[model samples]
Target: MPFWLSWAVWSAPVKKLGARPAISSGCSGVTMLNWLTAQHLVGLPGMPTTVQGVNARAKREGWEAQLRLGRGGGQEYSFAVLPKETQTALLMREVAQQEPAPAQQLQQPGAAQVVNSPKRDAYTESRLNDDQRSVMAARMVLIREIERMSKVVSQQRAIDTLVGLARTGSLSPYLAERAERANDRKNADRALSERTLKRWLADYRKHGEIALAPARRKPNMSVPVWAADFLKHYQRPQKPSAQAAYLAFQREYPGAPSLHAVQRFLAKLSPQAREMGRMGPREAKALLPYNKRLTDHMWPNDVWVADGHKFDAEVINPNSGQIFRPEVTSIIDWATRRIVGFAINVAESTLATLDALHSGISRVGMFRVFYVDNGSGFANDTIREVVERLGGEMTHSLPYNSQARGVIERAHRTIMVRLAKDFDSYIGADMDGEAGNKVHRISRADLKKGSQPRHIPTLNEFYERLAIALDEYNHSPHRGLTKIRDSETGRFRHPSPMEAWRRAEAEGFAALQPSTELSMLLVRPQDLRRTHRGLVRTNGANYFLQDLVPLHGDQVRVAWDYRDASKVAVFTLDGDLIGQAILDGNASDAMPRIVKDQDRRVSGQLAKLVQKGKTLTGKDVELRVIERPAEDDRFQQHLLEAEKFVALAHEPEADALEAPDNEMTRYDRWQQLDSRQRLGEALSDDEARWHASYPNHPDFKSIQRMYDHFEAEQARA
Candidate 1:
């Protein structure tokens, strides 16, 4: 019989009894043969030919039930009829059984649909310890194994196998091998005891796969106040040790946990928390994940990093003949890791930084960004302006964060620090203390003796060696660079910094050309006064040119190299460069004319004093002779005779001077008379008094010659 037709006729709720009805209680019921006939009456195939076949089919379908005849000698048998709702449910169940499996359904067209479960309002899983998470992971493996096994065998059979394994305290061969490979005991358990399995099954039915995870123990809520206080104090930069914190805690609160407990607590803390407690905030911050700056698409000259490193080795200063550590300011290309420029200075200063930046820009062309640390040399207005003028933006790393400028910092270690190791005077951070001190002492003694130390190289020699090292570094293979074939060698090799730079340039990453005015922008500026002589004096040297005369006495901007003050670039207050000025070596050598005139006046005053002394001495001798009574009359007679002789001598010269015949002579005679009168009057003063005391002085003839020459000049006029 067809399965559906037989099922409908036999399982129908209503049934009719047979005609022989008085022997047994005949409630309306159908026998197996009658049910079969009913199936044929419905135009379907009759039931199985034998009665046994009909009864076997009904029992297999779970529709057979035994019922007793009421008050009868024996019981009658009939199939229990299903209700209408039961029939419909069974029909639906049969239809579902014929449907394809879930995996098979996914392979069919239009079978994919989003299935959304109710969103959880609270956390689905709490934080788990490492051990708990590991245990949960192992249990999850077992659950997946069961699920996979159920596809090939009955679920009951799979459960029975797992239960048998758990009773014998053994695991599946696959799980045992995995546990041995992993060296984890927890993963070796792939089965559960019957009781445990039953509990797991109940949990799975309630909460799905999540219930397979191990439950965590409740956290201790009654933490002592002292423990909290200790944690707070321990994480400080001073970083008290756990024992020290525990000791302190005991003093503050006697009810705190024991030292062993505290130690255990610390051991279980998160790595970041432990680092914070023992190391410092800086170390703790390092534990956190940070976004890495990506430069994959960056080209050479896109960014440049600059920093100043105090060279570890002492070098001789050429100008001063002294040994000192020099600061090396360097600029590196971000993409190629190549050193583009560097400069050495006695200290880290704006001029030094500018020199490095200028060298880089001039050699490689302009860049787009300039990265630097927040150093006084780099964070100034001048550097900022110079960077902007070079068509780049200047960015400063966070304070005390050298990692941000790590390219140049690492370059210092890789190049300069390594170079310093070859020198005996290296005072590197890792140098042995006694040796460094001894070397330093010897160098100091040499300086005191006015001699150069053999251990140190001169500045020029240092620069020469540094250049070699830098060249080697730039051409060396770098891990950051991509591998490429060498064009000349025709062999595979890692790309060098210079090779990378060339490639970038060829690929349209060409650098911008800098202007001629770019260098002037990098120099240090000073407000200086220009002398009236067109000279500007700085550092005891006068810088000037003929063109600067117009700016004399005006306060103008003077830009010059601090290390070389022999020349300066002169600029107006409005930033116009007038001209360059050379040092005037003799600017301070010349004296003013007024000083010479003062020297002449002082010499004349000394001469007059000497003449006055002589006059006074002669007068004293004459007075002594006149004071003697015996010689008084004789002296008087002698003075009168001398006066008469002087008068006669003067009369003839005066008459000769007055003698004039023509108009010019008449004028000369008048001038001679006027000069004689004026001369007589001048002789009555101090000069004449000194001369009159010594009338026979040798200077008298020269004086008379001076007056005669004056008369002759007047006669000609």
Candidate 2:
């Protein structure tokens, strides 16, 4: 038998039995060259025997499986058994080669007409660069290309081609070059393995192009549940560290994320969120952008910023001769950066703020806006009313945001703090030492020790110095002010507050002339009572006004100048100005001089009486009574006679005096005898004669009896 026939016989059983070809245990697969050699078909002259030589020849000859099994390092691949039909076809083709074809058959018309598979058009490149395109978008493009190829070729064939390309790392020339540059040899050689291609194909079959992109890692919802509790514990004023918070989180959630994870999450938080845990809300809020308001285009009196700063230096109280720190209230013109007005008091009060505002408006003009902090003195209804009445609005800075009142705050630092440094009693924020040192600096011990009579200036002297300093400040060139040409000199110069005011006036932004009446409206009114004597009392002083005389016994509104108690403006309930009252005298005395003098004299007399040990008794009372004149004797006798006459007139009529029946004549004769005995003056002549004639007459007696009977009957009825 021929060697080919023997090789064919040896491979026939493996093909028929449907079993893998027998090979060495170390090498389960055979290369195309090795299989061809085993068949004893290698005797052709100049035919290469190596796998590389075979692969080159197979590639040129368009043999797919043979070329794939014969490429570089392909000799180690598992052998792919040919099908029985394929084996029979190979044998038949070999037999045909042995027998020459007839000329007629070879020359048959159109006998070699080629049948070619459909060729797909090359995929159009994407306009987006690799970096610009998302990984998922690129994958989608690739999936679309694969699907398009599947329409022209078999689905399995297309998938196998893609797998082969991926395994051989020949998907794209650019991608291969990029992999080479990155020195990723494994990835460059095998960009996507067969397993990866199969996974992608399976995904594409199931979910279309979306499946070509890598699946996202599922979000750990469980981690968020623990993280939420962690954040709640972490973001606090106490400001626990991430590790501390993680430990705390375990208490709330048994299975929390690790501390490292918590730290990474915290690091990803916003600046404000991170700051909020360490600092409080107020401080954290400061991290946000603020709307910076500028007053560049504003006129000199457009906005006035006001604030009260406690003076850092001690000054002697003139009245008490004691050293004390005073509070200074200052108002600054926002546009000009000028301290328009200021006031100093032993302490900050609404009165101090009012006075400062009043002075500012009086000197610089009415402002359009009053910017202030939420201080008790500046948040006053009186101050608000003052600003509103002046055709301005009052705006309060947000709590804890002092920057809103920057103008006045800066003024407090620039003017007051600078001035304070000149005094030995300076105790400002930047002062060197603690509270005790500051207290010792202002202590009265030095004065008690007769150390040069203590050098602290009196309040009045300090006020004078402050006034001079303010004048200098108003004239000094202001940094915030812009340069302006002097009208008189026609030369450019940096504008001071005074210069700014002058320039504003020249430019027709003249200030509104202050009205004293409007200013008085801002003065705080005190409900006070006026005495019937036309006196009003306040602040331990009695005030009197001629206009208040008629207003006595009425409740009046008294508004006084805080700086001076000499006079106060009094108004009625209806806001009618009654009159100004002058400080008359101390309210402690509260009495007319004459009355007070009398009381003093009475007190002195009582003191003298007590010194003499004099006491009142019955003998003293009898002596005092004996000093009076006695009553008249005649008057006593008249009183006794009148008493007896009154007793006789009231005596009841006796029953024996009444005579019955015809006893009328006897009664009439008795009446005549009683009348003659009682008569003080004699009757007229006619009366006397008639009485004598009818004295004992029976007719007279009968008439008298009838009258008596009529009287008795009338009385009974």
Candidate 3:
């Protein structure tokens, strides 16, 4: 063969002389090589250790000859025509001489390297099975011992000595142990043969340490016919166990294979295919590949994503004083990954979403685009209108695709979920079931008896904690944000969300600042109410103002703070601001009134109304005073005499009144009567009158608290 022809055959698979081939172990190390001079095969087993002797063997074997390409122009024999042992020895020497490139030179941040690269390290070792690693280690030991011996004696003589020691069981302890490990069956106690030791050295030299690993047979990937029936039972949304599915399959197909065989077939299925029917579309997305969202070009306030999360811990509702999980609506900036604003409400609603959005605008000004999922809270007209009014467009992601809003979804876990764990009342999915149940029972019991549990935070306290968490979050370093060089240290690190926002602001980024009046109009919830005369009626209350007079007898939209409905911001049907309206019934209801003032005003009005009623009834005449006459003794005597003829009937004894075991205070007496009335027990006439008067006592509140504590202690006992 020509030298170029031999080189083509040899280098085609490896691509380079020093590179390892991609073929399986059994087919490796069998490539044709370019022609070499007879002098290069001087030390092989079959060829004599002299140029003349190598030439004699080559001539006898009829090896093809080619002209030498470089240096001295002389005859060269084709490497393919050499005996098998000589050929193996030549390839092993060539493999052992190659050097590996350093890993640091090839490894770059976020870059992936090929698995078969010569720079094998711990990462490559992790991919091998324990058995393969053990065998590779043993082969390395043998190769090292050969290299060590070669320094003292000739390389061929060292190999002959080691083979003699192995056959006689006189090798060193470590080498004896390694010889057994190199066997196909690890515990066979088989001594290393001369051929086997040479092959081990050859493989290790070719592919680095990884080449020493024993070859693994390919698994039987062919699926049996019964696999389909087994899979039918296994791949269900209920996610039955393999054992359960096998039993079901056995019932349907009695001739099916054993469970282990079915399992082997299942193991061969790709992960995505195995879960085909075992999960819902939303859940199954976890196994599917996802495209990353790039925010490199986005700026602070460019896009804001909103989502609602139910707080995992229970808190006392401010209005009702009842234990419940508060819903937290979070608005996050996409570029900086900051939680700009959040609001806690009783539940998820459009109003809560709007409140959260308004808060974000107030903090960082209006965002350019409002991005959110297709939830009722974010996909409503009110939220849309608010975003539009703030000079932004509202867009909803595809339904059931919450992954698109990953920033906000991750925030819920990172911020609120972590915040919940700090509280003893946390009932998150990760909380222990017994501990959570105990908390629930204790909290409900205390609340039922009109007491607040210390573990359950009040709404205000929770708001304070949430605020602190958000501030810390905004100031902490975020991995998603771009890294910046620290001015003092001159090292690069991820910038905090707030730091990123400030930097962007310094780079001429300004959020849209809405006017105070417009912000108030946009954030307050709106409702349509009809204006009759000068009053706008809704929520069982009438709102009136002089400005509404022109819009009388027409329907208009009304906006008011949900926290306070006493004052409202009025608007026309065209969304034009009219004027503010006060609650028609009593604006004073919005404020506390002094007891003396209320009493004096009420008494005066009653007197005036009585006088007017008398006049209307025509009974307003005044009588003149006359002198008193002597008492009418005759009528008085007759009354006394008629009393003698009146008959008296016997009265039934009144039921004895039940009393408490201990002496009762005034409040206690009141509670006793109250409990009796609640339980359908009739009170004596005197007791009933006393009970009605007790509520007006000056110590009613303090005394009732004491009595309640006493009752609770008794109940617990």
Candidate 4:
């Protein structure tokens, strides 16, 4: 089914003190400007933040602003305030100008600032007295103690335990409650069911228990009554201290209370420090540090980066008639200023991304650093090892900060708009054959063919065509290079992208993939899982060819979407195609070897469907032979159908019309086929008309698309 899409909005709040206002986000800079101005109007003492701060915060949280239900039943839109700092994003929009507001009350020089509202001060003073403050501090200690029970949770008992222990510390019940509320809100927002959430909570809270009130009965431990009573009292307000315990004993006609009594009471508790993944930086504290360190892209292999954007593949594959969707990947040689290597794949993912790096390295040597966006694709180890093995570093563009890796960012657009515009039509549509019979198409009989074709090309035929296309792309001379070579000179002036790679190789540049013509495919990193041996496993099977075991559990990077068998095939890092390990398990996925079996299935399916269609026409056409689909089935059905109709009046065939046609008409005959094949197949009427319009027409993608459109319209009626 075709997926539906829509637009949404973002917004943020602004604060003002003096003439300076809080930076705003969402609809306009006015919100930011108004916020900043408002802050100035309030004459606040804190340092005034620039538009940059507002944008960063907005982007971090999702543009602050308004959310509203949109037009459709499923449509929920959020109109967020643009990060006030995103100049280009905001300036592009046409929002109303800011209205005049009050003048500023700038801060006085060298003065201490009390950054709090009078209302805030009064409320705090009234709500929390000296005793409450002391209790609050103790409460913090108790909470920490409860948290120590380990599977940490901020429950009341946990709070009381920590409060009882700390004596006094950074304990704020308000903040604690807020944090808990936020956690609950997040889960709520996630839309998980209550029972599921409770299950998760129970699992998380496995450490110690929390109680809403104090224990009714004290534990019957073998300790002195006076000492135990002292311990319990100390946890409560106005409870007895060590001195008071001794005084009480004396008053009751007793004498000896040892120092060991107090020491033993305090020694009952111990704490554990937090654990971490990498000893270097905690995930919470992990961030791009700003130390004013300047990077000039000064050295080779400094950074290998990646990013994603919607490419106008339509324009890129202009002549193509197949349903086209392509997201390209390109790696750049930072030091030499060249687009070292690239690949055009179906989606933005790590699976289809690894090959691009291999291409760059194989072509240019090794880039120092690999830079990429903070996306799941690059998060995999495939990218990490590729960069490290090349003796390069891997860095990432800050989230929403494209300027960090500006070089390759522009390179992608340059190739798409400047170099690739010529191939768009044929990339998605059938470009080769004269608009008819020889054209790649989906026929009515394809309904019974089974799977949706990735590109509708036989592997044997595609491998040949792919080689030619690669050669054409690599050798092309154009503006991206300093030298634009023509047929007249047939010479090199400045180096093109490919030529530059060749030059770099001469100077000791090493690439991952040595032979670009090996005919490879890209798979998203998601399909793969890392095994203990470091080999990448996918398709519910292990990839253990001898060449792969060395890297064992390492992920195999790909440069294209190979999810569909037609466009997808696995290869070794050493660059061997059509090879795999024998496996023993419940791996249900059919291997490419099953290609023959699948073909036979398609052929049998097509012959059966043709028979069914003939039944609709009320004729018993002689069944000549059932052909396998992979070999070629489109033309066979048309031939069979046409011949079957001819037999409708013939002597022996005339008796075949006795089969009932009240229900299964030739059109409904398509309903018997599988969805994938039906998607490519044309309706019987269109198929008949197409044959009449151009008996020898070859390409079928366009004709099938038209028939699908008509079928949809008929459905509406």
Candidate 5:
């Protein structure tokens, strides 16, 4: 047979080579001619002489490429893809014959014994899947020829070629041209276009061809002062028409530039004009062509993904005086399709993601893989340690590649849709504290008026309710599960997650890793700090124990600074708010500062309104106030009334304070008070305290807080 004929016969889909080819191993003395030819055919650093030799090399070097069973086992495909160098190596050694080192090869015509091109690094065999590499190689040739002619082509010809290539289904003409330059001529055989060719040269001129790594365009661009001003002033909605921008520009600069001149300026803003596009934080565009690890075969438990998303809800933020969005985090078991843990909060960021992960690991033991999107919060090594310590692999998806985490992404969608549709009711409401429960209750008429947009108390309230809603979801059954009974034990195979989890405890599934840091979270800051002799801090302010400077050097994280600020909180970085540092400031007068003066003036109006209400006795305002460490006269009076209430719930005196037929007198009182006060009038301490504190339940904390406030007011007076 002709050498080419024999080669054709040898090249037919040779099953004997197996699915995962082993072209990158072994150096057992090949004959000079075979070695040189192999080098030329594969151009790879390590090419085996025979099939057995290849397998032996692969086994010895563990370079066997992974082969995966395709969907429905339709085909066997390579799982392990390699870098470009390896692919080049494979083409040179396996596809081409070396023949003799050209007559031009002798000692590089007398240069120091030619280095032989570094012997093509041992990993030179093709790294891309075989089929893809062949296609890519063929495509490269087309790109080279296309670009070769494009540089000299006219503008109109370039445009026609660009359109032609797109019409012909070329994978990014720019990229094809790039691949052509990197690979040998034989590989550059794809269809070509003048537009693509010109673009390649233009890019080479601006950003060297090598810099155009197979990646997406970056989104970050430093906006020029003029552009920033343009964005702010550009009146026409999105991507303004040229005529509109030119007109607007003429108006802004008035004779500074004409429409024709501005249009010329705009022509400079064309996609090909700028070396880099406009900046949009660029975080999302940095990943292009995708990383091998990102696109590589990902099995469940290979990574754990974490992220926080805002859930639309009926929420009111009392502080901001407006409804704000609430956020929630979910830890999903990628393989089992289970939501392992969740945490909800007002802000969805790094700290919140940490809190959610904190809740997850504490509840579900540990996961093997942690995956999250490339958001600021999920990008921290501090947060990543949670996974690392748990022996879990951590990874962030390429920006916008939510599909990479198909399992959890689907779960997020499933839960969000289900919750939005079947959302029951918020668990609790401020109807129980701030203004006396005057929160407009959804009446029968309001309920009947479908989607009337009833008011929500606050973002905090919404989060609490979402927490409950998510819990219900975890306990819900799925159609995918099958009920099975063990042949011997007769236990059902599929149980609700909660039920299965409970049973797992009985079967030794609960083994807590007693890391000191993890265990410390159980201790509250109030008790733990005194025990540990540690100082405390909260909200960026630090507190030192009266006699505890000995421990000042030690650091801790502050957790719960109580609503009253009575005790400062401190914690270790690992989420353990285990101790408190009590405040021991003087009992004397405080020197008011400029900021405090402004604060007092700002609060003066709220005070005047609170005092406008009818003077109700402490008994009339039912509120829970935290017991102050030290006794105050007002606190004592309120404490006595609360004690009497608990003692007199069934007593006739309690009924005397109630409205006729058990109507809430306090609610009616608030309505009367609000009617008398203008929307923004100032009120006295007694009134302002009640005004702000009434919406929360009238518990001891609210009342004692009021009493403490009145005590401070009296002292100030």
Candidate 6:
């Protein structure tokens, strides 16, 4: 008999023994599923596909029969009264016949699309520790020996023989060793028992050798309040040690954890939690989830990002002979990771940014959008005007957020930082401190000593080297560009920037070209200026031409080439082209004669109106000088006044009233006597007396020490 038929036959008699009485599901009418003909369930599992076979099985199984209520009424069996296996098969078949939800759909057992999930037991080996794996391996060894011996005798007899041999220590060396190791762990008998061997056989049959791996207990994860407090101190910006934090916690709480306990508690924290407070905001951002910008849909010239970087290596200025790092302004295409244009300047400035834009736009046409940072070099009205004139939009990244411009920042490191390492004057952050200092000292010392430093390359040399490096970078494989298969190598690899650009070009991508007028308009700096007569004053210089005379007093826009400041391109306020104006440094007057004449005429007209109001004048007056009496007459009056006055006066006797002089006489006498003594002449009595008493003065010792010091120095020299 077929397997399906045999299963139906064996299960029919048992199902019929406990058949329940028919029961209704209590609906208003019978559902089509409640009463199914044998033919309706014929093709299901464990049921014969033929109607007659299914009916015969139903009769043998005592399935309750019902009459169909609708058209084509006939005897049908109650689906709810069928055997359990038959009902299960019908449910599975019905489910398979219906449409499935996309996410939860599963393929049938024998279907072409069936895919089996990996079993949990497949990774059992990985979950076991070394000791557990060793024990499992030993047990597997003994099980294999028993299986091999079972082929030669009855299964029980084989098992008994193996147990006897293991107990007597008379089995083969490998078998005996495995038996001893399998029983080596806690609470095991000295030798393998019959029951233990049977249990091992059953486990091997069910879950394979993984079932024999020793069980392991999970670690305790509960945190005490004291440990939590210690963690607060340990996880700080200062990053205190476990012991130090423990000490701090002990100061606040007498029940603080021990140092070792703190360490163990810290070990249980997640990696991200362990870094809390210990890392800066920027550094800690590495643990955060970031938004990834997708550039797969972008074309080569769709977006360009511009940034300025100060080169790490010092280069000598060709004009000034001074060593300094130059700032490089670079514009990169977001799609291909290619540097379309770049400019090098002594420092970051708006001019450098404009030059870089000109270089890029002139080569590859205008980009759709200009992405840049808020640096002064790129955030000015001039840059905005240049971008707008080229039919592109300019956007600025958030302040202090370099991550938003990570592409260009990374490019700086890859291109400029790598190039710096090739030069001897590299002073990057990662350069050896001693070597960097030595390079700095040498360059400065050489300049101070009036000699050029040979170690520092000139600006021109640096520019040439940078050009070569950029070219190499564009042609070399870049990891940031999309990966593609090489035709020649027949292997998958990342495409170079140039290769990616060429691929884009091959796919019919073309750049938007700027018109000649627009090109010229965007390449120079422009401003609004009002003309005086035929002259327009801008940038501290006056520009003049014959064509500007008619529009002298009108406001106009003027664009001047930085490289050629002698002339400026003039246009009307409405953007109509006027004639070019040349610089007029030799214009004689600060104001033109026409403007001055107009001013004079306006002054005369105002004066005429004011003259009509008043015409009054006043007469002049004369004055005379006062004189005093002559000198003889004045002297005669003074003598008469002295004769009229009378007074009594007394003077002290000069020699007796005079006391000995102190400060001034001592110094003067000392100087005079000292000079005389040095000349080998005799001193006067008054000088001798003063000089003799001067040594007893309170300031003499300090003055003598100072004199001794001065004399010693003079003598030594």
- Winning candidate number (lDDT): 3
TM-score of each: 0.56, 0.47, 0.56, 0.30, 0.35, 0.56
Q: Name the 10 consecutive residues with the lowest summed lDDT in model 5.
A: 108-117
Per-residue lDDT tens digits of candidate 5, residues 1-717?
684343223222233322422232122211121112212323243455664554455445434232323343211212122223443343323212323222121110111110111111224233324543454444444445556656899656655765476546674755555444433235435444454445444544443332122221111111122332232333333546656655665456443334453344344332322212233324323422343333123332344566676664445433333434566677765433456666555666665666666556544555666888877767876566655655667777777566576656666666755554333322233223443233335522343453222455334445444555556555665333345575557986654445444444565554344343442233222223322344554544445554445555565555441222444555555655444455543233477544677768756765654554325432333333364654334345444444332332111121123211211345455555566566666666555544444444322233344457679978987
Instruction: State, as a TM-score between 0 and 1, how close model 3 is to the true structure.
Output: 0.56
lDDT at residue 541 of model 1 (Cα atoms): 71
Which of the two, 1 or 4, has more lDDT? 1
Global lDDT of each candidate:
0.59, 0.57, 0.69, 0.39, 0.43, 0.69
Per-model RMSD to reference = 35.2, 43.2, 23.2, 31.6, 24.2, 32.6
> Which stretches in model 2 have alpha-carbon errors above 4 Å?
1-226, 240-262, 321-323, 434-457, 476-495, 517-527, 546-551, 571-580, 585-717
Show pairs that collide, candidate 2.
29-79
Candidate 5's TM-score reads 0.35
| Ten contiguous residues minimizing lDDT sum, candidate 3 | 645-654
Clashes of 5: 75
lDDT for model 3, please.
Answer: 0.69
In model 5, state the lDDT of residue 201: 48
How many residue pairs clash (N, CA or C atoms closer than 3 angstroms) in each of the candidate models, in the order given? 0, 1, 0, 119, 75, 0
Q: Cα deviation of 639 in candidate 1 (Å)?
A: 79
